[model samples]
Target: MAATKKGNTEQIHDLLYQALETEIGGVGVYTTALTCAVNDDLRKEWQGYLDETKTHKQVLLTVFEELGLDPAAAVPSRKIVKHHADGLVAAMEMAKKGGDPSAAQIVAGECVVLAETKDHQNWELIGLVADKLSGAEAATLKKAYEAVEKDEDHHLYHTMGWTRELWIEALGFPAVLPPPEEVKKVETAIGASRAEHARDDMLKHPR
Candidate 1:
């Protein structure tokens, strides 16, 4: 039983470390993405997300301090996370240099979606881990998870909505700008799906 508990604790530590790395990388992704954003609405939205991402990083730093972990400790998984983030930034830079603002915007949205996917999953797992534990550890993780959960959902789902609508517009369809997710303020997977399905009606009604 002791061995099992130790293993689980180690796993949680690794997760927290990876989560911190994700937020750090997320800041970079959002920052570079803003440079590629052509739509004023999208630019404003991404700027907000960028600020939130930075705050999320600080949240994790606090978590690390509370849990007695080194936020800067060397971890193997951190390298892979950084590599993926750097790739996303590089992809956006390539698109931006292609001299097509619209195309670059699309690429940026895709990168944001990718980065937020991992980030959202990290928080979800943290919440799950918190549920299984008790005492101060659970309390700390739960607080951190709750603080960041809604933002993570919004980051992933809304960016996905934006990416899809951007692609549809690029395909020359009558795509809805700002996406239904944004207008409806979706913060869950189900809400995002509903918003996506409502797009046809939105285009028809144009509210």
Candidate 2:
């Protein structure tokens, strides 16, 4: 029984380490995306996300310390996450080197949304598994999840909005300036879906 519990704790620690690495990558993604952003609004938004991502990395490190896990631990999952992030970074750099600034901005938006997709799911799964933990361990995971979940949601949904809108504009379709999510202050799954659909319809109708 003790061995089984130890194995489980090790698994959780591994996952947390991966998540910490992902957050570190998220900061890089946001920083690069901010540089590619052509619109002032989008640049400001990415900057805010970059700040949040930095804080998230620190928060994960705190969780590792709380669990007596080594924050410097190298794991396969972290390597995978790092590889994906590096690919995105390289893609952004490629786009930037080209002459079309608008296209580069669109590329950056897409890359950010892709990285945030994984980053968001990581936290959501952590939140779910946190229920299986007990005592101070559970408390630590739950606190970290609560602290960062909303920011993760904003990062994914907001960047998805930016990606779609930028692509629409690039294709000569009318795009939402700030996106409905921003205007409506969407914070829930239902709200995000509604905002997304509404933005799509607006693009299709194009008044």
Q: Which candidate has the top score in TM-score?
A: 1
Against the unseen true structure, what C-alpha lDDT does each candidate score? 0.94, 0.85
Q: Residues 1-207, candidate 2, lDDT per residue (tens digit)?
A: 755543476677777878998998888888888888899999999999899999999999998898888878778788999999989999999999998999999999989989988888889978876776667888999999999999988888877877877788789877897887777677667888999889867657654
**For candidate 1, lDDT tens digit of each residue in 169-203?**
99999998899999999999999999999999999
> Each prediction's TM-score against the native?
0.97, 0.91
Candidate 2 lDDT for residue 146: 98
TM-score of 1: 0.97
Q: Evaluate model 1: give its lDDT.
A: 0.94
